[model samples]
Target: MTAADDSTFLNISLPTGTPKAERVAFLRLCTALATASLDPADAIDRNLWFAEAGLGDLYNKPTLAAAANTLIDLVEQGWTLSTAYKHGPLLAPPPSNADPVVEKARVRRQEHLRRDPQLRKASVRRFVEGMEKPREFKGKLVTVFNLMRDGRELADSLTTAPDPGSVIRPYIQIVDGSRCERTGYLLHDIWRYFRHTWSNAYSTVPGRSMPILIRDAATPHHAVIGLAAISSPVVQIAERDEWIGWGTDTFLEEVRKAPSDEIAAWLAGRIDAQLGEIYLEDLLADNVLQPTDLHHPTNEAIAMLRADAERHRQKHHRTPLSEVRQIEQDPWVQRATSHLFRSKRAAMLADTLEASRTLRPFFSPKPAADGLCQALSDTKAKVQLRRLIRRARGERVGTVIADLTVCGAVAPYNALAAGKLVGALAVSPKVIAAYRAKYSRPSDIASSMAGRPIERESRLSFISTTSLYGSGSSQYNRLRWPAAVMGGPNDKWISFTELGRSRSFGTSHFTDETVDALVRLSRVKGAVVRVNSVFGEGVSPRLRKVRLGLAALGWPSSELLKHGRERIVYGIKLVENLRDYSLGIDPAPEYLLDPEQADETSVGVWWFERWGQRRAVQPAVLESMRRHRLVRPISHGARVPLPTDETDTTPTESMFFSADSS
Candidate 1:
């Protein structure tokens, strides 16, 4: 199975010769067969499974054998074994055909449902329960409890003659977290049932979150036009990070270089805070400490350290600071450092300063800034200024910006492009204010872990979302707002510009049950699981679990974690200087938009005139509304979309890697 003397994956061929596409396809076909649960000794079952999965058309027995041989060739040529999925659709990647996005979603759904049978039933059950007390108004379904007092014209207004804005006043409402009866429940219901084709399990969403409903600002029955859930943005987006320069080598270098003397003086003044972050980093680099020892020494962290020290003792090594094996766990570990430890710590700090960005995650801003502050004669102003300037890399990005995770209009409103309205209004001042208020308090988990209230700033910088499909988007396309109206300078504006394609690597393709198993397996393996779903620990906890879990299962982390299904990344900068602000260079963020200058009412009016009215006048829209009124069994536009093929789909909520993901 080894490659011929000079063969590589791209250059390998059948004896008769094969093109590059054909070779990749062969490798892809080989990869699919290899991952399947067929008997390794039996070509029959492998070929059968490949055919059944619809990947056999381009492959046959001899070609499939050749594919396997080519795979061996690849392995010989240093092709990673675990990322076999990357070679091609492991099993039925989207075919080049009409509605490929929908088709691909169908494949994903089929795989999920195949893994978990109850997902669809549960989704339908919850959806039906939400409509348990349905009240039909014409053909469209309605319920008393679900009704908003928004001024969306009912029935007759479906074919309304006037500009819909005058008769139908639209506004945005932040879902009241304290109450789940109206906006909250409706938001969840609509998002779970309406927007996506792959999955819509909103309960899976995590981190500090804000839910918003685009509603008609009317009394007695405000119709819910759309819903959006804003939470923490994904911390690692290559394109977005490249755009903002967060934690990038160049940005961190510039910041460090700008404060040239301060950086040097800080490294010299206090090598380690009483916390021993520096000592821990030195030990960690030398395989002497675990990541758990980074912060305050909790009982669990101490337990890990003790276990490791015990192992070291077993190996006849009396490591310095090993006395902590018997020390009662405390908030901070007080170490009487040896000259060796001190010199090693100093060397590590020197290396860290030399390559700050490369090793930024392991170091904390506080210890370094403390040292700098002390070196600069620690006065209140100097300390505060140093703290402000030396804010950690991930902290601001985690709290200051949010993602428009679950966003879209229901069917009836969707027909009017109200989803676009939802997109525009999602980034409105209402969302910003709501986010600020909701997360302004000290974080619960963070406070508990640190043994103090960790008050984090909730200054919302901008909102970002990804298109459902990788190919393109229709909803947030050209979704723009004038900055002048938003209290910014006349020349500026706001809009969700397509940032770029997000990394087509994630665990969304894996089912929840599958991920749960992977996590369990990962925990059993002992080293793959890192972030403990702890607040302020890291971004994308679920992503961490799934990816690490895969490694626990002995799969290639990056290759299998990769779905290769890229979604469009879109973002808007609420602040004039998102990059500088994210880097902590700007002491105060200059907001490009303000809540006072214009509210949801104004955004809705713009939506109404700009898109809704025009869409309403279309004969097609009128006919659709008329049909909606006549249908016996009312759907009410909350009908969930499925991959058109309707193959046994996984629970069709939103397989979008979820909200906090983006």
Candidate 2:
């Protein structure tokens, strides 16, 4: 056998107890005789077999001699050519009475059973019916529709246009949670339809969402055209924060400072008011203070003040002071008590001074007091306070954009371009005010008044939305809409891969099939090889050389590596990413429609195009790749090389590179 053939056999796992030298020699001899059209029984001459197998020089070697002696022993033991030459014992006894005709009939029967038309039709029908029916989703009754309905509604709405200023002009209204039982149900139905028909996967609408319903104003019943569900903004998004000129530092600082100020002010005010209402003279007059009392009148007054402070703390959810002097000279306290207790006519001036002295040390350091107050405050209250403060600071702190988690127009309305109107109304001051008002109530006045009032007019800065890539009906990307034309810079803000990784805050819909395909592909070839260098031997050098060769061969370096990790030690360049060299074109929807059908090359091309790489590799680096067996030569007219260990054999018309002459 040639070195290549020997290498191939050696790669296979050998059976246990098989002597390595004897097994190699036996396989080589059999392979050589088989290739030379000579029976193994006639090739017992070791020299002739060795020469044919291209191992003549090793004939006299100890390993070969042992193998020859083993073969002689096996022959003497009555082993025949057929039985002795076989690699392993039969896994199962040969089939009895084997018949090609019967086997063919059985295979045909299995194929027919697998392709049963009735079964296939029943399954498809069941799926379509399930998609058509209304079902409870996310704790609400939601209606569903298929893509056919989506396309039909869009066509009808486009052909019919309502007159401008007509009562039929579309308008968006906030769904009032308290009174929107019917509206909420309708919204869920619309969302279910959108999700079932348009979204790649289903996700429950987030809690505390404000559902906006778009309706035709001119229509007598205000026919619903679209639906949008807005939810709380993500706490942090690098792109959004950078765009709004708010860095991580500024955001953290403001969040920390605002709550601290509010807590401190509130505590100081409560303490001052409670202390002012109590007077030492009044306590003495009530006969609560006696001349012979063990506690001084001033001490009794301080005790009464402390008790009052505790009651105030419990009532307002403030932290009770472990020490009494914490709020003695608080600015808010001094301001509140100055006129009532520190006036020239005050009868208990000495006692009040003593009380202030007792309180000074406790409130001297605001940080300790702030920490105590924060710990004692209700968690919900603190969060609400922070949100209010963030709103009040406006664009300086960060832009408040409505996170449109679910935004899509209904059948006829969506077709007529009503989604843009909904998008516009989402950020409109009037709509925002209505949405705020619907949730606001007299009962919430106390809580609302606790935070500094935010100006609603300038609070909202923008609106953000996302859609699947290549989706033609994405409203966010539709340029003709007034909202799109009036909006700020429009670009692909985030990629699906990034969104998929961040489950907590990102909005991406990855179907089960896509995820499974990705996992399977990753297992086969997506995993990167770790190159741990021991005594300077590592795969990194080979990889680097391969990269250089590809670059020298006109392959783009930016497209060489893909985003994936293996064992967290090596960054793997996927075979899929190699499509950039094989097919230098962007991927089309048909190419990526089914991930299961996607091979490494097609996936790499799709990923490359999806990321929009513009950089190209320098020719100087191509030499390195050539030396590392990373790339192989192909035919003159072929863009992709034939099936080799280095390249995929799957033929494609979209090949990028011509076969290298060298």
* Top lDDT prediction, candidate number: 1
Q: Give the TM-score of candidate 1.
A: 0.62
RMSD of 2: 27.3
lDDT digits (tens) for residues 1-662 of candidate 2: 12312211211112344456655655666444334433322214445655665544443343333333333222221222232224421111112124545433332232222222222244433443443344554564432221112222222232343522232345555655332233234444444433333322334442235776665444333445566766645444544443332343444344455545544443333334323433334334544444343123365544554454344333322223222233233343232222222221122233333433443333455524454345335454344333323422321221224456666554433433445555544444344455445434321111122221223221233334443221123354322211112221242121111111111211021112222333332223323322121111112333343333323222232332211111001010111212111111112111111212212222223222322121112222222222322122222110111122233234233322221111
lDDT of 1 at 564: 49
State each model's C-alpha RMSD to the native: 12.0, 27.3
Runs off by more than 4 Å, candidate 2: 1-168, 176-195, 205-207, 218-221, 250-402, 412-416, 441-463, 470-474, 477-662
Error of 2 at 241 (Å): 1.9
- TM-score of structure candidate 2: 0.30
lDDT of each: 0.52, 0.33
Quote the positional error of residue 561 for candidate 1 in Å.
1.6
Candidate 2: residue 34 lDDT (0-100): 33
TM-score of each: 0.62, 0.30
